[model samples]
Target: MAPPLVSLRVVLLYLRVLTVAFLVITVIILSTNSVTIVSQGNSMKFHFKDVYAYRYMFSAAIIGLFYAVIQLFFTISELATRTKNPFNYQLDFYGDKIISYLVATGSAAGFGVTKDLKDTFLALVVLDSTDPVDKLFSRGYASAKNKKLSKHQSP
Candidate 1:
């Protein structure tokens, strides 16, 4: 069996690479598309909007960052709670309970932070009032909400 620490290190390295790649992509797209529009006629009007693609990319980055943090926390918690030694046959199954609490708390914080940031950014960039709500549901929350609703509605 592979050492637990080795596996955790591999996972963290993969996440770091993935995050750097995403950040690079986001910067490239956002910078390349940045523009300003001006309207001068009496009837003309102006509004600012995020490049739609950049908005999506920003949201994805937020989600990815949250996921990476949560994963790292879980890995750390697992390492802390493990009781098995290479030369010892005794193992504490109760360690898993601690891991569970750590995972739950980490996941909640990660998701909440990501959701709040995404909502705020979307509100700033989306000109229409309804666009944020539409984007929120379409991204991932709708499926999660539907699952909860179905659980409650089931007889």
Candidate 2:
């Protein structure tokens, strides 16, 4: 039993390390999440700073940082205490619940932001531009519209 608990503690340590690494990456990406487009001496920028949903994601990442550190602390404290301590299970459950809800909310918010950004980018870069792919899609659309019109006009 003691050996299994030790192994579990080690595993938790590794998990915390991975969680911290991801949190750092999330912060950096959110902080620098922007792209600049220059065309014909005009420039436009798209970045997370201008989006509220992205801010929510960044906030979640910061929350995750604190959660991971606190989890690490609890893990260490559990190991330092005697094995008969029954409160560790409750602590684990509470920690997991809080982190779970936070991550779920973050995921939802991030998804909404990404979908919006994708639509905007496509409208700007694909629909309005004369790229070869756009021409192909445009031809298909015209044919579809013509077919619909012909069907409506049929005697």
Candidate 3:
């Protein structure tokens, strides 16, 4: 028997939960960092010397948090609609990946601009490691090669 079709409402609800979770986490982290930065004063020597640097960092964090939340929503929506809608499913994976990359890149750029070298470096690393097309193509090529070898061996 075929698996039961998933509901879009269920998916949307899940997305909503995920978005809330992300927001909560982001807020917690930002608040913690803010407190720490304020408390440490000049004791915590950050790379960014200008007052504008702090503004940039806060802005970047908020933007990154929002981006992450939105991405999660899209992913949930995609999964929810996938069985009933193959086209939407196809778009979701690529679209989410692209959006994620953009968010990461933007966050990193913001960090760089804000002189948060550590954050910038980490973002760059993450962006470098994720290549959906390369992974998909390589897996396909390997599977095809394996199938060809198996066919020859059977004959």
lDDT of each: 0.38, 0.57, 0.39
lDDT of 2 by residue, 1-155 (tens): 78887777777766666666666666665676565555555666656667676677667777767877787677667667735356757766776667656755765666655556555656666333434333323332332222222111000
lDDT of 1 by residue, 31-132 (tens): 343223222322212111233433444444444445444544554554566533432211222332333333334334334544674577555653434443
User: Model 2, which residues run further than 4 Å from truth?
Assistant: 80-88, 124-155
Which stretch of 10 consecutive residues in model 2 shows the poorest summed lDDT? 146-155
Winner of 2 and 3 under lDDT: 2
Best by TM-score: 2
Which pairs of residues have clashing backbones in candidate 1? none
- What C-alpha lDDT, on a 0 to 100 scale, does residue 154 get in candidate 3? 5
TM-score to native of every candidate shown = 0.32, 0.69, 0.33
Model 1 alpha-carbon drift over 4 Å, by segment: 2-33, 36-48, 83-155
Q: Tell me, by lDDT, which candidate is best.
A: 2
Those runs of model 3 whose alpha carbons end farther than 4 Å from true positions after fitting are 4-20, 35-83, 103-155
In model 3, what are the clashing residue pairs, if there are any? Answer: none
Candidate 3 local lDDT, 1-155, one digit each (tens)? 23433454454446545544543443343333321122213322222223343344335435545654564565565455554356645554564455445434433443444344434534553332324323322332332222222110000
Q: Local error of candidate 2 at 78, Å?
A: 2.9
